[model samples]
Structure formats: structure tokens, C-alpha cells
Target: MNVKNIFAAVAILAATGSAFAQQTEFVAPDAAFQSRLTRAEVRQDLAQATAEGTTAQRQHDGQDTVYAAGGRSRQDVRAEAIRAASIRHYGDVNDTYFGG
Candidate 1:
């Protein structure tokens, strides 16, 4: 192949390899909620001591948000986390969805 074609093929191969290789190490985004400026480094600090959950992303306050929590079961932690996320998104537990 010509030099230009070789360069193009190398570029495509590098791009694809990088895309697939990136999946080898899963790194969730930082669980840093904008609120709670007074809290510790991350959301895990606020989770109940005995609870066990994972950092996850969700839509909150018109932006992407992340949180971490732990509980007796994964379901319990997920439910609580979602509720907290709702509060962050809507400003109140009872806020109507249409309002936002």
C-alpha cells in the first residue's frame, strides 16, 4: 500500500485497539456530588457505616451525578441511593416530575 494508506490503516488500528483495550480496566467516575461541600472527600464517607453499595451515575439537578452507598442488600442500597438522588434532582421528595 502507499505511505498515506499505510498511515491511515495504522491510525484506524490504533483507534480501535485503544477503544477495546480501555474496557480492560473499569473505572467509574468519581462519586463527587456538587452539594455537601462540608463532607469528606467522597460520597462513600456519607454512606451508613454498615451499608455496602457501589458508586454509580445518575441524572440529578439537571446534571450528571454520582453517589455511593452500602446496605444489607444491594437492593436496599440502590433504593436509598435513588431516593437521595431524587432529592438532589428535584429539591424535595414530593416534587412533581413535570416541574423540572
Candidate 2:
């Protein structure tokens, strides 16, 4: 390699190494840290929040809180899915149906 190319490569590597070396380090909390609330008090507060329906609720994908009383049942949905799968085309339409 030429002197300029070797020097450019070294400079780029040095810059990257310096940038990585100057990253911030993680510092742990103090050993004397204490909680303001007791375990029993925290538990009671959590229970009260849960009873009042104020706790955070995580809904999974495709799930919602609303309920439909007259919705389709599990068996109905499964049968419909099976029927649809049985009639679904798994091959090319033009090649299978036409003389291609």
C-alpha cells in the first residue's frame, strides 16, 4: 500500500479506538441505599391498586379488553378454519387449471 493509504487507515483506526475507549462506564447504586416504603406497606398498596383496577395491564398481541357476549365460539372458529383450509389452492392457478 502507499504511504498515504496506510496513514489514512491508521488514523481511522485510532479515531475509532479513541471513540470506543471514551465511552461512559456503568456506576452501581450506593451500598447504603434504602427504600422509603416497607415490604408490607408496598404489598398493601399493590393489593389496593389491583382491587381498584388501577394496576397496569399488559395485553398480548391481537388481544383486547372488550368482550362480545354473542361472538363465535371456539368450535365454530376451528370448523371455519378447517373448511377454508380444505378449499384453499396450494398450487399455481394458471399451471393447474390451464394448459400451461
Candidate 3:
């Protein structure tokens, strides 16, 4: 209404806009995990695993699956990627959670 109130409102709006923009630009650790995955491959693995059971169960069931090899499974890779990104972005994972 008045000049002082208008300026205060504009300042508050500017601060809020900047904070929202910063948050949108910020990438979460889970986003980094998803970004590293090949969507097609991950989807296929997930579908197959879901159709059967767990990936490990499918492997034990004598199904020659791509994920049965001696490497990290899709979930493991995703988890590790998230953990790495969290450590990179936040300095430490446990510290971020525990406030240490």
C-alpha cells in the first residue's frame, strides 16, 4: 500500500524467489544415482526381476540373466552412486543425516 510496505514486500519476494531458484537448481544425491543409470537397461532388469522375483532369486533359479554376472546389481549400483553423490555434495553422508 505505502512506499515502505511496497519495498518490504518486494524485498521479501526477491529473497523467496532466489531461495526457490537455488533449490530447483540443486541436484539431490538420488537424482545423481538415477542419472548414471541407463534407463533402458535398468528398466529391463527391473521388469525381468519383478516378473520372476529378486535378481538374486532369478539367478539362483537357473535363469541366465544379464544381471547374474559378478558385478554390482542395479540396486547396488544405484545405492552406491547415491552414496557417492551424497558424500560429494554434502561432505559426508552420516554427517548429513546425524548432524555431526
Candidate 4:
């Protein structure tokens, strides 16, 4: 083929390929598989257990000593203290609102 014909053919193929590659719809989750996912309470329980485990591991590994020292900045310590106090006052604040 001539140069012009070859270039037109290539451009048409490229445009058609890209148009066919577009995704136009959301894929819904499988109902049965989704049902097996941890619910909010189960997630909270797992997260709490994981955090407790992490804290215990840190304590066992002498991380508490390092954490107590200058490893954390004054601002970080103050923030942690405020967070602890808030949790004490309100049990547990909403996870979304706690950080912000």
C-alpha cells in the first residue's frame, strides 16, 4: 500500500481499538461472596484485637521504652494524650470523626 493509505489504516485501527476498550458500567459484587465479608461489628472487633496484639508485641519488643523517649515529638505526645482523653470521655468516638 501507499504511505497515505497505510497511515489512514493505522489511525482507523487505533481509534476503533480504543473505542472498544472503554469500560461503561460498574461490575456488581457477588451477593454470596459479599455476605461473607466481615460486618461493621466484626471489623471493629478484628481491628481492636489486631491493635491489642500490636501493642502487646511492641511492649514485648521494648518498643514502649523507645516510644516513651524522644522517639515521638512533643506534638505527637500531646495529640496522643488528647486522643486518649477523648476516648476516655466518650468511650469510643466515631472512627471517621476521631482523626479529623
Kindly give the number of clashing pairs for every candidate: 5, 0, 0, 0
Error of 2 at 64 (Å): 13
Q: Candidate 3: which stretches are off by over 4 Å?
A: 22-100
Per-residue lDDT tens digits for candidate 4, residues 5-24, read 99999999999999878568
For residue 66, what is the lDDT in candidate 1? 62
Q: In candidate 1, list every pair of residues with a backbone clash.
A: 51-70, 51-71, 52-70, 52-71, 53-70
Candidate 2 lDDT over residue span 38-74, tens digit each: 9999999999999999999876777667976868898
What's the CA RMSD for each of the models?
A: 19.7, 6.2, 20.4, 17.6
Please tell me which predicted candidate would have the highest lDDT against the true structure.
2
Clashes of 4: 0
Off by over 4 Å in 4: 1-16, 28-32, 37-44, 51-100
Candidate 1 lDDT, 18-96, residue by residue in tens: 8776466766687564675655645555575426544364446755466556447988888989998687453455656
How well is each residue in 22-56 modelled by candidate 3, as lDDT tens digits?
Answer: 44476666764535578898899899988888765
| Candidate 4 local lDDT, residue 16 | 90
Model 2: how far is 4 from its true place, Å? 3.6
Clashing pairs in 4: none
Q: After aligning candidate 4 to the native by TM-score, how far in Å is the CA of 55 from where it should be?
A: 8.6
In model 1, the Cα lDDT at residue 44 comes to: 51
